[model samples]
Target: MNLKGIHHVSAITANAQKNYDFYTSVMGMRLVKKTVNQDSPSMYHLFYADAQGSPGTDFTFFEIPGAGHTYPGNQSISTTSLRVKDDAALHFWKDRFTEHHVDHDPIVELIGKATLSFRDPEGQRLMLISDEYNQGVEPGIPWSQRTIPAEFGIIGLGPVFLTVADITSTKKVLTEILSFKEISEVDHFKLFETGKGGSGAQVALIEDSEAKRERPGRGSVHHVAFRVADETELEFWKNRIEDSGMPNSGIVDRYYFKSLYFREPNHILFELATDGPGFTADEEFDELGKNLALPPFLEKDRTHIEAQLKPLQSSKE
Candidate 1:
């Protein structure tokens, strides 16, 4: 069984309201889900993605009130990349960021792709990578209703960056257990890709042995998930990961898709997720994320869940 590409990247946020504002109003991504974190029903878990909330486009967050600041270091999912249409789109974002006062750097070339690095208000590290010449995994369609033009809109997630203390052990887990192939390495970073290699199916690794381990808080990535075709394949991965002696969360019914989570050698969380029965499973195509949604298991506690969350939208926009 081959892992397709990045499924989603979940992160942390201290304030859900501000997170919603920045992503929807600034980043131009659609809020596809405004539900509570299933594992911890008291706080909100938001999902931002393309028009359909496609598998490869999902960027989610779990709100933790008064979450502390993140101390960036090794053994962390250092940076998350968002894919744009081309190099021109990369510059358009630079100009847009200036208008909105978003913290970002000038465009620079990385492994032949134009890249722009930026940070959110909470100090979340992010990059916008051009997919102009991408020939591997396809990107998702950005939300058409967004203020940003479709041509320059973010299409999907790109290579996830990992900073680890032990490059040898992390490389073994990736190349051997996860089946990633090294495509290139430059300076201090090494690029690995799985399945059909390209910007969409890649992970960039940076070994920083001198840095201390990351103190995760608001703005830190929670985990990165890779795509599996379906539950059958996910089951196969469960056994394979188990055989490799890496402890994993066995098959979990996430309602939208099946999932099993595990951490690689560097203590970075990784999840294997299916691609079917996605965001539209419970909500209508046009009505997604308008109201709070709960899974079948959490339906019984709807009243309590609603009471805990501050209303994401004052009224339907």
Candidate 2:
């Protein structure tokens, strides 16, 4: 079955508070959820996204303190690209960056579009492009404290690259199981497409022999999720991942979506997520990103969980 699209991308960060400020304040995304990392409750799992926390709109990060710095290699590949409304919007961002004194370079042409590149507080590379064909998405509340205008907020995440030592296994899973098609290969980099012509999903697999293993910490991407149509297709993917001898986490409800996780040889976490029971599941449209939201499974532990959390708020610096 063809996957629907991307779900959300998760990453690891050093300081939860700093990450929160950058994603919400600087980027203008809504802090859809303020919950602890399920595996490590001490750290947070901060989710940043557009209105309704739509799939492909989310960029999540976890705070794991004291994690050593990873050597950025050609294989340490992770890029968070965003789709914009038009080239005029790109000009708007250029002026916004200049007005806010944010460090950035002039727009660069790639994939036949003018794009601007910058980095987040955690050093994750970010790019923005005004591609009119992307899905129409509503923006969340205008973060009044943002350095940039809310009208030009990021719509959704785009092609995220993965630096892997070997692309064979991961490539197999992506093509054979996930139904991704190889679009092109340039300079030893393989690009795969998983969505429709324009608004679909894309990934670049860069093979690097000396690429160091990613140590989950600040600035590290947590995982990239592939979208499934519904629960039925999610089950199909479960059997497919298992049939291929890749160990996977069985279907787990994530409130906004259900997810299954696995790791490729290079150790980048990969998630197969279903899109449904969206951001509105636990929040009102007008009041999203205003409070903490707990998954149904974690609702009973809210009091205990809140106590364990380091008081944090998504704010602009």
Candidate 3:
């Protein structure tokens, strides 16, 4: 079975409140899920996405107070891109970034599309790529209450950029282990595409054999998860990864979706996750991101968990 496009990209945030404000107020994305990290219930794991928290639209973060600044280098998910409607949207964002004092670069053509690179307050490397006439995977609609005009609003995620030491090892895993195909190359960067290839289903590899490994902290991406159709497909992927002799976390119950996490040859974390039983699983659609949501397994520890977390309130709440 073929994998779908990206499911979500999870990064680190030292201050949940500032992260919330920048994404919701400045970037104009909707805060779709307000939950705790299942692995570490004391910290927040916030999810931002399109109107209904669609799979490919998810951009999430895990809070870690006092996290140090990330030192950019190799073997890292260096940059994350958000999908905008067209070239005009890219210009719209440039203007908006100026208005909000958001750090950004002028729009330019990259990998066959117009892109505008920018960074969040915490120095997260981000870009806005236009999906004008995009015909691969479907993009989610903008959130209803977003102050930014719906036409110029951000949609789903675009191509994720990976900076690695050696492209050979990572490329093998991407092609043989996973199903991505090498589509194009520009200097040190090679572009790969998976199911229904487009901006939404691509990853760019930037090779720097001499660079040091990245020091991940605040603003560093923790992992990139690709979308699988369902639990059955996720199980199938687990078997394939195991057969290929790659050590993996097999068939994890993520509450919202089932997942199988594995690290590629370059040590970049990759997760295969299902697309269903989403944020709506524990809360109503309109009520999403409004309250602290705990899965059934974590329900018993809700009191303790609540006590440990600092309040991360937002307008959605």
Candidate 4:
């Protein structure tokens, strides 16, 4: 099965409004979509990406609305890395950071690449890698039209390492249910790859004996969304996961897409998301990210929701 790429990466955040500001104003990503968490409607579920909310380009936030924080550890968890186009864009991002008064560490080398590490308003650890080695032609359109030259854009997603208390169960699930092949194992880390390219082949899980289960709060990964071909492919995954006796929440409408959610042995949330009816579903190419869009269920309540929402800061350059 050929997986397309990452549909999106969802993370928990402390404050909805502050994250909204940091992602849009500081990071220069457009707030392509904003809506309340369907399960927890009191808090906002904000999405930041290139103008049109394209897959792989997206980093979403599920606001915790004044919750306590989550600490980082090596229990199948690590920093979230966003791949930038090249080193020059790293300079551009540096300048932008200085101009906007956003703080970031000086560029450093990590796993043989130049990376800039930083935190969002809620302190989620994020790193941007300025390397696109062996990247292919861009297929999906950019959600944001902010002129991300091919060399400086986020071409690939870095491997997400997990920390599981026991690697045996999760390992079985990955190999049998998810079809991941065990690549190699090192100290406190086990790597698995799909032998595919783009975003599909880039997921890794790590197990640590001393790892403790941590709750998802601000600054922690809410979920890692994997790609599926379409509804048919989604059904295949659903059946596979169910057959494996892993608890799974079937399909749920996510407005722009559909998804199924489950938790691995490490307790990190995983989402199986589709790749269709993208940003163009609600907005036109020319008008992407120009305004807030509400799903059909929330359209009637738009006025009330809009009234409760604070004004957005302008990011026009």
Question: What's model 2's overall lDDT?
Answer: 0.72
Segments of candidate 4 deviating more than 4 angstroms: 74-77, 91-103, 136-156, 184-189, 198-201
RMSD of each: 1.4, 3.0, 1.4, 3.2
lDDT tens digits, residue span 171-246, model 3: 9988987889999997557999899988789999989889899999999999999999998888888888999999
> Which tens-of-lDDT digit does each residue in 121-196 have in candidate 1?
9999999999988889988898874468999887999999999999988899888888889888975689899988
Best by lDDT: 3
Q: For model 2, name the residue pairs that clash.
A: 10-222, 11-222, 13-218, 14-218
Where's the lowest-lDDT run of ten residues in candidate 1?
308-317
TM, every model: 0.97, 0.87, 0.98, 0.84
- Give the better candidate number (3 or 4) by lDDT: 3
**For candidate 3, what is the TM-score?**
0.98
Candidate 3 weakest ten by summed lDDT: 308-317
| Weakest lDDT window of 10 consecutive positions for candidate 4 | 136-145
lDDT of 2 by residue, 51-100 (tens): 55777778888787876664465434466677666677788888877776
- What's the CA error at residue 91 for candidate 3, in Å? 1.0
| Ten contiguous residues minimizing lDDT sum, candidate 2 | 136-145
What is residue 202's positional error in candidate 2, in angstroms? 0.5
